[model samples]
Structure formats: structure tokens, C-alpha cells
Target chain A: MKIAKDIKELKDAISKFSGSVGFVPTMGALHQGHLSLIQKARAENDNVVVSIFVNPTQFLPGEDLDKYPRREEADKKICEVAGVDILFMPEISSMYHSDEVKLKAPSYLGYILEGNRRPGHFDGVVQIVMKLLNLVQPDRAYFGKKDAQQLVILQKMAKDLFLPYEIVPVETVREDDGLALSSRNVYLSAEERERALSISRALKAASRLIMAGEFSSEVIEAKMSEIMKDIDVEYIAIVDRDFRPLKKVKIQNSIILVAAKVGKTRLIDNLWV
Target chain B: MKIAKDIKELKDAISKFSGSVGFVPTMGALHQGHLSLIQKARAENDNVVVSIFVNPTQFLPGEDLDKYPRREEADKKICEVAGVDILFMPEISSMYHSDEVKLKAPSYLGYILEGNRRPGHFDGVVQIVMKLLNLVQPDRAYFGKKDAQQLVILQKMAKDLFLPYEIVPVETVREDDGLALSSRNVYLSAEERERALSISRALKAASRLIMAGEFSSEVIEAKMSEIMKDIDVEYIAIVDRDFRPLKKVKIQNSIILVAAKVGKTRLIDNLWV
Candidate 1:
């Protein structure tokens, strides 16, 4: 696999491929979720490009930016094994400059769940993704559904901006214990790790409720809240595919989302019904 | 010139061209200035595309959005004469949606001078330009320096976002009377029209001052302000190419800008030294 550490190198690397290019953008510290995206990109396109940029703008002042995981050597090995044609690892300086254009997250859908907890987070996410998308000019970009809000917002932006690339969403990858894989998962202590399972369990409970003809949002949220009683539950929401609030669930269009703090490590999980 | 009234049509029209495209985005009411951009595009590229979008987002409330000039037939004739291959005139609904992602101007440079007078104006300008740029996918885009601040801000955005297009700056076109050609110039009464000449005259005076080796920005602005005394001078600024405030003229890198109101019509003019 070729490694491109700057924009100019990445552009030259991307220029060599005339066939369809599939891109997967990550923040390094590759997990099962990121690997799955890379594998899918490799299978789908003639050229696969992966970018590992832990965008600083996406993190709020108090967020875990400094402590974010960075296992670069391992990430490189995984990409090489996964048959990534090119891996773009750009420095922050090359990606951003002071007093340049920025993006604003959609006021309603963008600021409801994950955005509510961290205002302006998605704006940074959209901005960095735009920069990367333009630089890569991929035929299709892969994104894991683990960050559901991020995926939805990016899809909206790509469509709204009339970008040439397609946004292909892959399902979230999880551990055998039903814990959604996240880089933040490393921050959890031994006991805290066990406690994180409740998040997925709560989502599973919500899924079961939907299967049992429980369409009321309040009832499903109540059951999920009960499953996550021990953990610090931030919010349990039922929203449509567009992230608009749904008083009652709409099968095949609804998503049950949950956010909670397990020993100071915040995690999010969702189940599409 | 072929006219495309929606995005789908525009895309279809654009697909027929395989050679280098030079794009000129305008708000209709075509004047000599816009024609100059189109003529330049025609000369420079195999395909020339011009978009006539009023772009409502760029106009803040209480601004001249509703009353903005529109001369479709005249614009079409001018484009045809200028050898434009296509003219995209999408409806507002086709270009924007509610709860969509938007762009923000640089916090400092974006909010000074013209931005200070109409806050959030550049955000809309950047947003629409990004959309048009992506949709057209031109090899080079033409922009007149008459809107000097807008040109500078867009240059910053294109570079920061890594957009795959070259920004070709066109010289500002003026009338025989030295008045900058603008659609808004129509709003001026016959008497007001003559009074508006002060804007360009002041810019000319500033240029002459620079030629005579007067480097102090204060002295230059003071002389220009004296020339524009009859009108309500909004701002007279001397800044470098990047819009940074310059204490003294930097000769080759300086821009002297003036904005003022004549009989309720606002006009802007600038001189690049």
C-alpha cells in the first residue's frame, strides 16, 4: 500500500487511478468498525483510499481530543492487510488554516441527540469531511453506522452540496458482548467495560419492543431506560431516518438511539428497526 | 446558449461537454462586467458555462433580495453573443432546502468591511458558490474583482476546501463615466447616478496617491473620504491582498476599498495597487 502524508502526495496518488475509487475516512486507532469499512471499500472499487485524520475541530474544548487513541503502526498494518491501495495520513497544518471558511451543522437534526450533548461538534465533522472529500474526489465514500448522526449529517451535506461522490453507509460492527466498538472504549476500566454492555442491551431491548408491536416511543424509551438504569443515561430518543422526532415508531424507518456515560467514558448506540 | 432551469437539467447539459469548462456565476441582470467575464471564459476554455442565480441566501433581511434585478431574455442574448455553451438558471427550491448544511465566513476577515455592514452575507455567497462549483465541476471559474471582498473570500474558500477548480480573477469592468457596472446601479436616479461617480473617483484618487509614494493608509483614506463627502461613506479601508489591515500601503499588495450610500442605493468600488 502507498502512504501519502500530505495533500500534494495524496493528489498525485489519487491521479494514477482512473477507475472507481472507494474512500474510507477514519481517525486512526483502527478498530473492527474501521477495518470493516476498509474491507468493503476494497471489495467495491478498483482503488481504495483511506484517510486517518483525527480532526481537532470536531472536538469541543472539554472533549477527549488530547487523549484520543493513536495506534498508527497498527492502523497501517491493518490497512496493508486489507488491501488498501493508498493510505492518506495528513498533518493538521496541511488540512486546516486559521480564519478560513467553516461549516454549520443543521440547526434542528444536527443539534438534537449527540449534538445536544456537544454543540458545534457536527459542524467540525462536516468541515473536515468536506476537505477530505474534495481532496480525494472519490466515486464512493464508506462510513460505518456506528456514528449514526455523523453518517446522516454527512449524507445530507453530500446531497445538499451536489458533490460528485456517493455516500455508502455500512452497518455498525460490534463485539461478541454486544458492545459497539469505539476508540473511546479503550478509556473504560475493567469494571466500566462490563458496564458498557448495558448500552447495546438497551438498544436490543428497544428492538424487541418494536418487534412485539410496541410502536409508542415513550414505551420503548422507558424499557431502554430501565435496561440502562445503572449507567448514567444521557438521552433515549426515537427518530425517523431524517432525525426528526417521532412520537410513535415507524417500522423500517425508525431508529432507537441511546447515549450514556459509563465511568466517564461517553458512548452512543442505536438500532434501526 | 442552452438554458437549464433545474439541477437535473443542468447536470444533463454539463455531461455533454468533455473538454475544459470555464464557469461564470452571476445573478442575471447581465451588464458589460458580466459579459467581460463570459468573453474571457469563452476565450480561455473549450466550454463556457454561466449560471444566473439570484441566490436568495446571500441577501440578508432588509437587503435588496426581493428587488434584485432579473433580465432573463437580455442575459440569454448576451450569453449567446459571448459564445457561452450553457446557462444554468435553477430555481431557489432546486438549489437549497430547509435544515441544510451551510458555510461560515472566516471569523475575522469575513466579518470586516462589507461583511460588517451585512453580517452572514458571505456565508450565503460561499454556500451557493460551493454548490455551483460542485455541480458544474469547471476547470476554471471566472469572478470579476468588482466585488473585491467577495472575490478574496471565495479565493480563500476554494484553497481551504481544495476544490478542483482554478479561480480566474477578471478585472472589474466600468462604464465610460468610470462608474463600476452593477445591477444595483439601476436603482440610482439620474441625479444619483452622477453622484455615485464619487466611489470610483475616490478609488482613482487613492491610486494616484499611491503612485505619488504616499504610503500611510490614514492619509490615503482621509483624501478618499474627502472626495466622497457628498455621500454617506460607510467605510474607507486600506488592506493587503489577504484583507489584513495595513498601516501603510504595501505597493503591489494593497487594495483601497470604498462603500457608501447614494440616495438609498449602496455602491462599492476598489482599486488594486
Candidate 2:
């Protein structure tokens, strides 16, 4: 696998490829969730490009920008093992400049659920994603469903901005205990890891309720809240595929999303019913 | 030439082309300025696409958006004569949606000169241009140097965002009497048009001063102001190619820009020294 450390190097490397390119952009802790995205990209395209960028803009002032994981050696090995054609690890200085154009997330879609809890987060996501998409010019870009709101926002951005590439939604990867895999998972303590399992359990409980004919959002949310009561639950929302609030779950169109504080690390998980 | 009035049609039409595409995006008044851009596109690439969109976002509340020229028949003939392969004219509803992601211009570059006079104008310009560029996916995109600040801001956006297409800056076209060609030029009455010539005259006077070894921006601006004494000048400032204020002219790097109101019509012209 070829590793490009700069924009020019990556551009030059990508320009030589003649066939369809698939891209997987990540913040680079490289959990199984990210691997699923890369594996999908590898299976679908002639060239697979992976970007490992801990974009500073996406992190709010008090957020985990400084302490974000940077396991470059391990990430490179992972990319090599996954058959990535080009592993782009651009310096922050090369990717961003002082006083440049910025992308703003939609007011409604960008400020609900995850967007509400973390304001301006999606803006940074769209900003970096746009830059990456333009640079890669991939035929298809893979994003995991674990970040459900992010996936929806990105899909909206692609359509609204007329971006040509396809945004493939990969299923979320999970632990044997049902906790969703996340880079932030490394920050969890043993007790916190155990607590995080309730997030998935709450989602599963919601799923069971749905399977048992609990179509009303209010009842399912109340039930989810009870399941996550042992943990510090932030929100339990039932929304449609477009992220609009759902009064009643619509089976294939509904998503039951949960966010909570497992100790100090906030974790989120969802079930697409 | 094939005409596409919607996004899907244009996408299908463009997907069949196997060669380089050059694009010119306009608001459809069919002036010589626009024709020059199309002609350049036609010469440089295997296929040429032109889009006529009177972007409402770019217009300030009191500005001439509704009354902006829309001579589709004449514009179509011009594009056909210029060898344009495809002409895309998307309706406002088709191009825009409620609660969509938006692009914000840089605080500094987007708030000076015309941007200052017309707040949020560059934001809208970048927003629509981004959409159009994404839709066209051209090898090269053309813009006239007549709108110097817009061109600079767009160039910065392309570089900052890592856009794949080249932004070609075509020379500003002008009439024999020196009025810069613009779709807004049609709004000027015959007498107002004669007075509008001072905009170019002021620029020419600044050029003559530069040729005579005058390097001080203050002194040249003073001379430019004196030449446009009869017109209601909005601003007569000299700045660098990047649109930053310049103390003295830097020869190849300096730009002298002017904006003035002739009757109720506003006109802008510039000279790249």
C-alpha cells in the first residue's frame, strides 16, 4: 500500500489510477467499525483510498481535539492488511488554512439529536468531508451507520451540493456484548465499558417493543429511558429516515437513537427498525 | 447543442461525454462578456457546458434579482453559435431545497468592496458556484476578471476545498467606449450608460498613473476619484491579487477596482496591473 503524507503526493498518486475509486475517511483509531467500511470499499472499487485525519475543526474548544488517538504505525499496518491503494495521512496544516470558505450544516437537520448535543460538530464534519471528497474524487465513499446523524447529514450534503460520488452506508459494527464499536471506546474504563452495554440493550429493548407492536414513539421512548436508567442517558429519540421526529415508528423508516454518558465518555448507538 | 432544464437530464447528458469539459456559468443576458467565456471554454476542451442561473441567494433584498435579465432565446442562440455541447438552465426549485446545507464565505475576503456593499453576496455566490461546479464536474470552469473580488474568493475556495477543476480567469470584455460588459449593463438607460463609462475611465486613468511610475495607492486612488468626480462612486481602492489592502501598487500583484452608481444602476470595473 502507498502512503501519501501531503496533498500533492496524494493527488499525484490518485491521478495515475484509471478505474473507479472507493474512499473511507476516518479519524484513525481504526476499530472494527472502520475496518468494515474499508473492507466494503475494497470489495466494490478498483482503487481503495483511506484517509486518517483527526480534523481539528470538528472538535469544539473543550472537546477531545488534543487527546484524540494517533496510532499511525498501527493504522498503516491496518491499511496495508486491508489492501488500501493509497493511505492518505495529511498534516493539519496542509488540509486547513486560516480564513477560508466554510460549510454550514442545515439549521434543522444539523441541530437535532447529536447535532443538538454537539453544536457545530456536523459543520466541521461536512467541511472536512467536502475537502476530502473533492481531493479523492472517488466513485463511492463509505460511511458507517454508527454515526447515523452524520451519515444522514452527509447524504443530504451530497444531494444538496450536487456532489457526484455515491455515499455508501455501511452497517454499524458492534462488540460481542452489543456495545457499538467506536474510537472513543478506548477512553472507557472497565466499569464504563460495562455501562456502555446498556446503550445497545436499550436499543434492543426498543427493537423488541417494536417487534411486539409498540408503534407509538412515546411508549417506546419511555421504555428505552427505563432500560438506560442505570446509566446517565442524554436522549432517546425516535425519528424517521430523514431525522424528522416520528410520532409513531414506521418500521423500515424508523431509527431509535440513544446517547448517554458512560462515565465521562459519551457514547451513542441506534437501531434501524 | 442539447439543453438540459433539470439536474438528472444534465447528469445523464454529461455522463456520456468521454472528453474534457469546460464550463461557463452565467445568469443569461447573452453579453459579449459571457460569449467570451463560452468561446474560451469551447477552445480549450472537447466539450463545453454553459449554465444560466439567476441565483436569488446572491442578490441582496433590495437588489435586482427579479428584474435580472433572462433572455433565454437569445442566450441559447449565443451558446449554439459558440459551439457549446450542453446548455443547462435549472429552475430555482430544482436547484434549491428548503433547509439545505450552505457555504459561508471567508469573513475577511467575503466582506470587502462589493461584498461589503452587498452583505452575504459572496456567500450566495460561493453556494451557487459550488452547486454548479459539482453538477458540471468540468475539467475547467471560466469566470471573467470583471468581478475581481468574486474571482479571487472563488479561487481561494477551490484551493482551500481542494476542488479538482481548474478555475480559468478570462479577460474582461468591454465595449468600444470602455464600459465593462455585464448583464446589468442592460439596466442602464442610454444617458446612464454614457455616464457609466467613467468606471472604466477611472480604471484607465489609474493604469496611466501606474505606467507613469506612480506606485502609491493613495495617490492613484485620488486621481481615479477625480476622474469619476461626475459619477457617484461607491469605492475606488487598490488592493493585492488576494484582495488584501495594498499601501502601494506591486505591479503584477495589484488590482485597481471601482464600483459606482449611474442613475439607479450600479456598475463595477477593475484593472489588473
Candidate 3:
């Protein structure tokens, strides 16, 4: 696979291929989750492109911008082995400049869940998404449902901006245990790693309740909360497809979401019912 | 020419024609300035498309959004006469929805000059430009040099976004008496109309002074200011192509801009030196 570090060079390289391009953008700590995205892109399009940019803007001040994991050599091998046609590894400078345009996520949709904890986070997200979408011009772009809020926001952005590409939402890839896969999972200590499982366990519990016809959101949230009681819970919301809160669950359209802090590392997980 | 009022219809209409498209977006007050842009688009591509939607977001709260002129019949005739193959007149509902992902202009460049006078203006400009460009999928898009600041900001947005279309800047259209052509010029009264000539006169005087070897920006601005004494001048700036201030004019790379309030109407004009 060809590697590109500059915007003009990457654009020029892609320009030569006048075909359907599939793109996967990542934060470069390669694992099964990222590999799965690239694998899907490689399988679906004539040209598959991946970008590994640990974007600083999306990380709020004091939010682990420096500590965010970076495994460049491993990431390169992962993409190469996955049969990605091109790997774009742009420096922060290549993606951003002083006095550049900015983007803001909607207040109603953005200021809930993840955004509630980190204000202005999705603004950075929309800005980078706009930039990356512009840069890639792909036939389809792949994003993991692991970041469910981000995926929803990106789908909204594509619809609002009239972008001519599909946002393919791939399901989250997890380990043998129910723990959700994440690059930041590396930040957890052994004990914290043990505690992180609570995030996924709570979602599994909620799913079982839903399957057994326990439809009251309040009852389900109470049960999930008891399981994650040790962690500092941020928000526990049960919402419909549009993210409007539902006091009671609606089968086939409900999502149970939870975010909790496990010894300085924040963990979030959700289950669509 | 075919008329389309939404995204699906426009795309379907254009898909029938297997040729390069040139797009021109306007606000439906088809003046000679807008005509020039459409004409250029018509000449450069196999098919030409025009969109006339007075975007509400770009206007400041107290700006003339409600009163902005709309001459649809005249505008349609002008587009037809110019050989435009498609005219898109999308409703606001079709173009935008609630909980939108918003775009912001580059802080430094977008916040000065026009941006200074009309805050949050370029954000709306970039927002619409992105949508229109995506929907039209044109080979080239045309913009008038009359809105010089707006044009520059749109170009920056395109580059930042990695939009596939080219932006073509057409020269400003002018009246016989040297007033820059604008649909808003219709707002001027007889007395205001006469005073608007000073805008172009000031630009010409600055150009002449620069040609006579008075490259100092102070000298040129001071002299131009003298000619526009009766008017309430907003800014007389000598700047480079990027809109950054230059102390001395650099012949081919400089622009002299003037914005003044003539009677109850505001007018702006510039000369590319």
C-alpha cells in the first residue's frame, strides 16, 4: 500500500484513480476495531483509503491529547496486511492551519451524552469530519458504531451538507469477553481493565431485560445503574432512533446508552434494542 | 431550461445529461453582475445550472433578509437568455432542517472586512456553498468579484473541505457611471445613486496614485479619502491577494478596497492593482 503524509500528494495520488473509493478514518492505535473498518472498505470498493490522524481539536484541554495512544508501525502493518490500497498518515499541521474555518454540532443532539461531558467536542468532530470528507471524496466512508453518537452526527452532517457519499456504520468489535474494543482501553491499569467490563456488562443486562419484555426504561436503568455503581456514571439514557428520550423502551427503535469513569479513563458503551 | 426545487430532482435532471456542468448560485435578484457569472458558466461547460435561493442564515438578524428583492420572472428570463440548462429554486425547508451541523469561517480571514461588518456571515456562506457544490456536482462554479471577500472565503472553504469543483472568479460588472453592479443597488434613491459613483472613483484614484509611484498605502488611502469626503467611509484598505494588509501596494498582487454609506444605502467597490 502507498503511504502519503501530505495533503496535495495524497489528493494527487487519489486523483489518478477515477473509480469508487472507500475511506476509513482512524486515530491510529490499530486493533480489531480499526482493522475491521479497513477490511470492510477494502472489500467494498475499487480503491480503499485509510487515514490515521490523532486529531488534537477533538481532545479537550486536559483530555489526554498527549497521552492518546499512537502505534504507527503497527497501524501501517495492519492496513498493509488488510489490503488497503492507500494509507494516509497526515501530520496535525497537514490537517489544520491557523485561522481555519470551524464547524459546530447541533445543540440538541450534540450537547447530550459524550458532548455533555466534553463541551465543544463535537464541534471539533464536525470540523475534522468536514475536512476529511472533503479530502477523501470517497464513494463510501466507514465508521464504527462503537462511537454511536459520532456516527449519528456524521450521518446528519452528510444529510445537511448534501455530501454525495454513504456513511457505512460498522458494528463494534469486542474481545472474547463482552468488553467493547477501544484504543483508549490501553490507558486502563489491570484493575481498571477489570472495572471497564462493567460498561459492556451493563449493556448486556439491559439487552436481556428488553428481550424478556421488561419495557420500563426506569426499571432497566435502575438495574444497569446497580451493576455500574462503583464507577462515576455520567449519563444513562434510553432513547429512540432520533435520540429523543423515551420513558419506556420501544422495541426495534430503542438504544440504551451509558458512560462512566473508571479511574481517570472514561468508558462508554451502548446497546440498540 | 429545466427547473428543480430540491436535491433529488436536480440530481435526476442532471444525471440525464452526460456532460460537464457549470454552476452559478445566486439570490434570485438577477442583475448584470449575476448574469456575468452565469454567462461565464454557460460558456465554460457543456451544461450550465443556476440556483436562486436567498439563504436566510447568511443575513444578520436585522439585515434586509425579509426585504431582499426577489424577481423570479426576470431572473428566469435572464437565465434562459444566457442559455442556462437548469435553474434550481429550492425551498428553505428542502435545503435545511433543525439540529443542523453548522460551519464557521476562518477566524482571522473571515472575521475581518465584510466579516467584521456582518458577523457570522461567512459561516452561512460556507454552509450554503458546501451544500450547493455537493448537490450540483459541477466541474466549475462561478462567483462574482463584486463580493470579493465572500469569494475568497468560499475558496478557502473549498480548499479546506477538498471539494472536487473549481471556483472561477469573474470580474465585477459596472454601470456606465462606474457604480458596481449589485441587486441591492436598487435600494438606492436618486440622490444615493449619484453619490454611489464615489466608490468606484475612489478606487480609480487609488489606482492612479499607485501608478504614479506613490506606493505608500497611507498616501494612497489619504488621497482616496479626500475624494470620498462627503460619504461616510467604512474602510479604505490596501491589501495583498490574501486580504492581509500591505503597507505598500504591489502592482499586480494588490487590491484597493472601499466601503461607504451613500445616503441610506451602503456600497462597496474595489480595484485589483
Give DockQ for candidates 1 onward, in order. Answer: 0.84, 0.93, 0.77
**Residues B1-273 of candidate 1: C-alpha lDDT, one tens digit per residue:** 689999888888888998899999999999999999999999999999999999988899988888899888998999988899999998889889878998888888789999999998999999999999999999999999989999999999998888888999999999998999999999999999998999999988888888898999999999988988999999988999999989999978988888899999999988888
Candidates 1 and 3 compared: the better one by lDDT is 1
Better of 2 and 3 by DockQ: 2
lDDT of each: 0.91, 0.92, 0.88
Instruction: Give per-residue lDDT, candidate 2, residue A209.
Output: 85
Candidate 1 TM-score restricted to chain A = 0.98
Candidate 1 deviant stretches above 4 angstroms = none
Q: Assess every candidate by TM-score.
A: 0.97, 0.98, 0.96
Tell me the tens digit of each residue's lDDT in model 3 across B101-215.
8888999778899889999988899888888999998999999887888888888877776678899999999988899998889998988888778888888888788778899
Measured by TM-score, the strongest candidate is 2
Write model 2 residue lDDT over B1-273, tens digit each, in one string.
989999988989999898899999998988999999998998899999999999999999988888887888999998898898999999999999888999999999999899899999999999999999999999999999999999999999999999998999999999999989988887889888888887888888888888999999999999888889888999987899888889999989989889998888888899999
Better of 1 and 2 by lDDT: 2
Our tally of clashes for model 3 stands at 1
lDDT of 1 by residue, A136-176 (tens): 99999999887889999999998888888899999999999
- Identify the leading candidate in terms of DockQ: 2
Q: Of the pair 1 and 2, which is ahead by TM-score?
A: 2
- List model 3 lDDT by residue over A1-273, tens digit each: 889888877887898786799999988998999888988888889999999888888999988889788889988998999998888988887787667767889888888888888898988888887788778889999999878889888999889888888999998999888889888888889999888888888999998998898999999999999999888888899998778999999998888888888998888888878
Clashing pairs in 3: A134-B161
Whole-model alpha-carbon lDDT for candidate 1? 0.91
Worst 10 residues of 3 chain A by lDDT: A93-102
For model 2, state the Cα shift of residue B260 in Å.
Answer: 0.4
